[model samples]
Target chain A: MKERIKVALAQISCKQGDKAENIRKIEDNVIKAKQQGAELIIFPEFSLTGYTVRDCVYELAETIPGHSTTVLEKLAKKTGTYIVFGMPELSEKTQATIYNAAVLVGPDGFVGKYRKMYLPTHSVFEEKRYFRPGCKAGVFDTKLGKIGLIICYDIFFPEVSRLTRLKGAQLIVCISASPATRRTFFETLTAARAIENTAFLAYVNLVGIEDGLQFWGGSRLIAPNGKVLVKAKYDEEDLVIGEINYADIRPIEAFVPTLKDLRPELFDELREAAERL
Target chain B: MKLKPSVLDLKWTEVETKIRRFIKDYVEKSEAKGIVLGLSGGIDSCTVASLAALAIGGDKTLGLLLPEQETFTTKDVEHAELAAEKFGFKTEMIDITPTLKAFYDSTPIFKTTDKLCKGNIKARTRMIYVYYYANRLGMLVCGASDKSETMIGYFTKWGDVAADISPIMDLYKTQVRKLAQHIGLPKEIVTKQASPALWPGQLAEEELGIKYETLDLILYGLERFMKTEEIAQQLGAKKELINKIKLRWVSMEHKRRMPLTTKMQYRTVGADFRLPRTLH
Candidate 1:
């Protein structure tokens, strides 16, 4: 039998700017994921404070060891499972700046945090106005495996996942608060990222209607070979679990050889020419 | 098999709340007093009227009965009145026969007396009244076109489809009917046959030669990328019927899209130059 790790993708609706209520729901899901024997549980972007917070994001931003994590750390300790969720972070270094950030916690408490790099400014997204983009891609070492964290819009760029994979991340988790519109794009893009990186991908999305926008919840898990192992139904909150086999990564990369074939020198040349233009 | 498909299942309460909030938000943001809709006494119009009433209260909602003298039925007018009474919305009746005659007598092109041409005029004439009242009352014109009719180009270009916003455009005709009943509309209006009421006894199913139920199923199948044969099997309908619906859906695709623009520059109006009206 292959070495399997159980992961839970919790697709739940978050109330905008209601930190206390959202935290209660998150704590409940932590207990639920643990009951199902999930070693790792993930949530959609801004799961602590709903997406579309807009101007209220400044008011909702919290420090990592602030009120939210203090409560979540206790839940992680009680459940004995790793909890990964999205929230707006009040920067410790820069008091005035806020970043759209994801935090990771485990039984021991306070694993790591990754701020989102890409702030979408077009269409329905006005994220750039509120979020100051993070400087680095983040990978955290956990008991289940080495995990990479990226927020919703970061997945649109292939470099984020590629860099995380090169850093020896066996599992990549993307937390998204994507809307119903352009849902097919998210589905296709996530699967492609999993295949190209040869890493197990877990995606969690929020659901519910707010401010005239509907967030479609089709949270899913993709295997290293690019097959969708499990997918939650759209427009509903669901807790879906899938087993990720870490052993499958090596065999898949050996066959496809995407990472093995080095093209960094060619990419640098293309980058230099584009810079001249 | 499963007699009732789960595809049509909807959380009507959640849907209603979302739409009500949508209407309320749009009206408040646009700074309009209310919304105005033409009530043909058909299921579509009735549903729109009810939703508008629920959103902004019946006192703010306006329903107009713009009936042509020859083609329009008195029963539809009666049904419209009943809906108004049930929803407590204000109503007005405008006989548009004189307006139609005024335009017809002026144009030599109208001498041939084509039904399609006359129908288009009637529809457009009603829109003129709808917008006139909407402007005078500082309200937005609500459209009654649903996804089923919208998919097959069943509406006139700038006539029946003319509106500031559509509350029910995403719902199919079958789903609209379900919503009608869910909203506690009178049984007579809920079960009434759908028609544009362009002419007397102009049944929609009769003109299309396909029932709304089957049409909705075919559309659902097509949207899901099912083959014609597979849809025929699933709906227990003929493959020719499925193919005809598919062809109509494909051919009428142009009607649902903006008018074609020849690329004159790096970006066109609705092509690469993309920004929602909200940004400006």
Candidate 2:
């Protein structure tokens, strides 16, 4: 377990449903991140296929350990690094259903996969139309350490990150294809989640114009203390690199012990009262 | 990147072209024959008139002079004429005193017939004439009010504020003055003190209790989301005045929004169910 892990956030523009082109860009970025001496490289939500693919989600959905993962696995091995990205996944249990999934690949090949737990179905988002909610959340042990993954909209619910951290994840990677609206919320929420969980949080967001909504690419890396170590340029494609010290999380937790002070009995009682109401 | 409020600085030529194009496209989309506006000879009205003329053409623009007997000066009529003549737009004069007096005579309910009540009557009277011509010519009424007045709720409700389109609505008074000059409006109209001309000796600055210069700076600060003390310090003005402006802005929030409707149904008009006016 390394004390400090270098992570690179690749904020890239995605052409709608252009899998080949997006894959090429992802591969190129992996090589670039490797050159920059980053152990883990991250990409925005739907970096494999693209966001806003309404019905095309069916056509774009790929199976895990499938063609796209095979390519990404080779890229990770060749670059000697770990790669995490978002895509529409064909549910293994029920192949008919699609899930917004994030795949993690390292030098050892496929590490783990996380389907987005919360499917957003609101203004400008119709993910519920195409995706099934992920069943569970857990952590993946990489060479860097125990790392957790959650797609967009999952961060809105605190339980998602908390559960991941409880499952022994030291860092959480939140990949998003978020638009400019409510951008301040995303930024503040990422920091808030990091501080609350006493875990390192890295967010990579898509940039450029997509379906008339401008995606703000203010990707950031936040320490457990809610310190923003690096933030990428807004509305522009750029690589943001930051170092996460695994040792930093220990002292932070030792000082505050937010997780240690949890009262699950009270939380369960509150949940029961809320349900009754 | 951090958002710099300096991006709001006006480039006169680009602004002019954009507004003209916007008006032109709006008129075309609304399927209105042209535009009609009440010309008060104030900088706001003159600027709107110039833009309307540039938009739909002088032949399609109609300028109305609705002057109350006591409130309007001869210089007001002359300046309005100067703008109309320069733009080559047709003008008609409607004496609004009789209309105002009719309301006063019919409803003697007001215990006090003060300047405020009378000024509102004048504004609504002019509104009637502006709409009358607009209806006659199949035209939309273009309002000449600017952002500074609108923000403070200075204009009378359903009066000069009523419009099918407010072309200069986003520009502040100072910016409007700059635009009026840039469009080659006569110096008389561009340099004149802004007045609603609803009553005699009613200057907009005096009525609003803030000069357009100071108001614009404070507004710019507000636009950039600056704190009141920061704005006051940066502009070398009073913190009290900045706070007052902010209070006025908050109090006048209703004027900026559509009337609130109770949502008893799943979808209420302007509450849950909203479609662009241009949508079929």
Candidate 3:
């Protein structure tokens, strides 16, 4: 039987340094996505804690199994839908170090967490000064499909999406807090990743300005074939839903066949060199 | 007292072209060979590389792709190579993994597997290398950062944002795309996502927790004279979302300007540096 899944990309705006308000906003979006018959819902990065907080890292950071996750866990159970969202996670052992983490919650319980791997230090981004990067690339199994979760900067690396695909992720969900100056880059990049990997890609971005950085919110869903199935309005908080048919993926892969013709040997050599160094 | 007219009212494209022309003229008059840039395979770098190639002949331009252990994919490298080939510029690839590892091992603070520290080290290291090659080759290092990044102070103080000359500094994110297509850049480079490839697996939007489209729309509205409520209404965005973006803009104001100085006297560096000094 061909499986079909309906996914919602909650491209919402968030307030900087307002954890309570951000959480409340996310909860509203989750309910809306669930009511729309979405089996899975994805929120922008740091949905609980707004991006670009000034020295509020310690104040806003929470633990993984802490209060924020508990709320999401309950929400997932209540909605009967899997939820993926971003937050600032304070390590249990070390209070000083924080991680920019993405947490997944299934209807049954918490599924998995993936921390942002890339911490940008350049213009308007000092993530390296705040959050720690994640080490592992993870894919979670869910009723919708094999799901891969990657935080914002992780999407820029094609290998991350490729590895998720190799781990049997049919759909890649990305949570982003990209600023407005780089909007076109985000839109084109997400579609390219989907086309190259032949996987369904859903990107949820924050809208509005945090601190002085402006966020250009253009949340969107791309099919395995790289066609934009649905795109959210720019600079707007929107609930974008798209239908994914597992059967359609095979046909798309058969037609394009970029993944089959990959030069793994060359990549292996590169990886080997990277690891050796 | 009312202030003089701000330069912010010009159309984005006109402003962008003026900036590009200014940089090009400065380089040409200086008798410099051409511009050299470090391509991270992100949108900013690609845009800058393309513009530099166009400003000067591809023969005089150079694009360097420096990859570390955590660089996500070879696609960016491929894109840079393809761009160089299409534009007729010299291209080089240098791996900084050994240098990064050696430095990390030598520094006690980086011994722990803290991703943030490691990522920053990589960024700073890459910047050092870019300058090393730029100085040796006698070419100006062209910066690819845009206004949004500049406004939010998202860039490293002297790392990725450092440059001898910046061509696209004034354009916003959306404006850059228009310019990229306007200048006949290939779809591959034009369409790629904006990323810093600091780690093996990373995406800019996913990491930042917001999408660029919405952010840009809000920014355009906000910067171009729309009120917060009006912006929300026009874009169909939620009021809360607009408020969030506005707050971010206000908070990150520090990143856009020079470091604050204690105004013990009436004049400070930023306040007093206004007069243009020229050697007679």
Candidate 4:
């Protein structure tokens, strides 16, 4: 018997540098999604800290199991829905360095944490200055299904998604604060990742203009076949939900045979070259 | 000519039309032909080309497609051609690979495989080509960069960044798409992925590591909503994405403004460069 999971993609507009308001907004959405019978509710990237609050990094960054995560833990327990969200998590031992982390809070407690693997340093992104990139890819086993969470920039690279899929992730969730100018590309890339990996993808993006830039929210859910089951409105805030029949994924995978066609030898060669560099 | 007082209260569309008309009249009064823009086949260039074609007839507007060895796909070239065809302009393609190679071969700094340096050189090389053509053709160099790209210093310093006039500098990428569609751009040109074509298989998103969609969202969240960490939590976006965006805002602070001055005196440039010019 295949498990059926209901997922919700929250396309919310984040206020820049305002922690209190953002938390209130998330709590409200979590309750709303749970009430709608969603098993898993995902938010956009960096939901706690607004995307462009450059000067507020040290001010807003908190330790996991600290204020923000503790609140999320309580919310998950109350809602009985798994919550996956992004935050600037400060390491316990290394207080000076910060990690761009995604927290998974289940009904019991904090279930898992996945730090961003790819730290973009060039052109409108200078992550090397602020973040220490995570070294490993993570997939958490949940009652809903095997879930994988990758941050915004991590989705651009195939290996991150591939690695998570290899770890047996049936559903891959991406939280994004993608802007309007790059919405078209994001949509294309997200769909591609889902199709190639043979996994259900739920993508949530931040909407509205922050600072001087604009975000075009086209949050969407893609089936394993690369078909968009549900897409959120761009440039507007909305709650998007979709039902996944895990039974259907196997047939699609059997027909397409993408996973069966293994080019590991070629990938290994490419990996070796990257390692040499 | 008398200026109407009621014009101040006009709707935004009316005001925009008036401003455009005023500029057009001024250009015509000066006896200048239509604007000349270098169409790089990227979003910025396409916007500039469309505007130039609209400002002046196709005959008056000139669109130049500059290509180098690093140009990943000919689709960019195709898009530029289609834009010119749709907008009614003269289109020309010039390969700058030889010129760039010549410069690289001569320079001692080319020993190392510094992709950044090489990329910058390509941009500069393209700029030189545009300026040269614009000069020979006696036309102004229209810039296609948007405020989003300019704000974070994503553009080349003196390369694709150089321009005599920029029409869309204040518009965000989202706004640019809206305007592009509003202007009746062909689907082929409008749907194309953006790239500088600096290197083979080079995509703007892949190179930046941060998708523009997310970058734009963060920028919008910070600038408009003023919701800091709360927004991040609400969206479930990675803190790293936020951090990266913030880092860009801080690091590229220099690119967003005029060159800094030592401020030795009270009347230095940038701080106080305002002086009434006396024309003889």
TM-score of each: 0.61, 0.55, 0.53, 0.55
TM-score, cand. 4 vs. native:
0.55
Candidate 3 ranges with C-alpha deviation above 4 Å: A272-277, B1-280
| Model 4 RMSD, rounded to 1 decimal | 19.9
lDDT of each: 0.85, 0.85, 0.77, 0.75
Docking class of 4: incorrect
DockQ class, candidate 3: incorrect
- Quality of model 4 by C-alpha lDDT: 0.75
- Looking at model 3, residue A3 earns an lDDT score of 87
Cα lDDT tens digits, model 1, A1-277, are 2268899999998776788888989888878878898888898999998887765666779888788988888888888888999999998887658998989998899999999999999887888777799978789888878899988888999989988888878889999989877688999999999999999999899987555677888999999899999998787789988899899888999999899895998888877998999
lDDT (C-alpha) at residue A20 in model 3: 76
Higher-lDDT candidate of 1 and 3: 1
- Listed per prediction, chain B TM-scores read 0.95, 0.94, 0.85, 0.83
lDDT of 3 at A92: 92
| Per-residue lDDT of candidate 1, residues B136-213 (tens digit) | 999999999999999988988788889988888888899988898899889999899898877767789999998888
Interface RMSD of each: 8.0, 9.8, 16.5, 16.8
Best by TM-score: 1
DockQ of each: 0.07, 0.03, 0.01, 0.01
- State which docking tier applies to candidate 2: incorrect
Query: lDDT by residue for model 3 over A1-277, one digit each (tens)?
Result: 1289888988887766677787788789888888888988888888887776636667889889899899889989988988899898999999789999989998898998988888888776878877788888879887777889887778788888888888888889888999866777888899988998888888999876554355677888899888999989876677889888877789889989877988888998998998999
Q: After superposing candidate 1, which stretches have Cα over 4 Å from the reference? A: A1-149, A153-175, A180-212, A216-277, B1-6
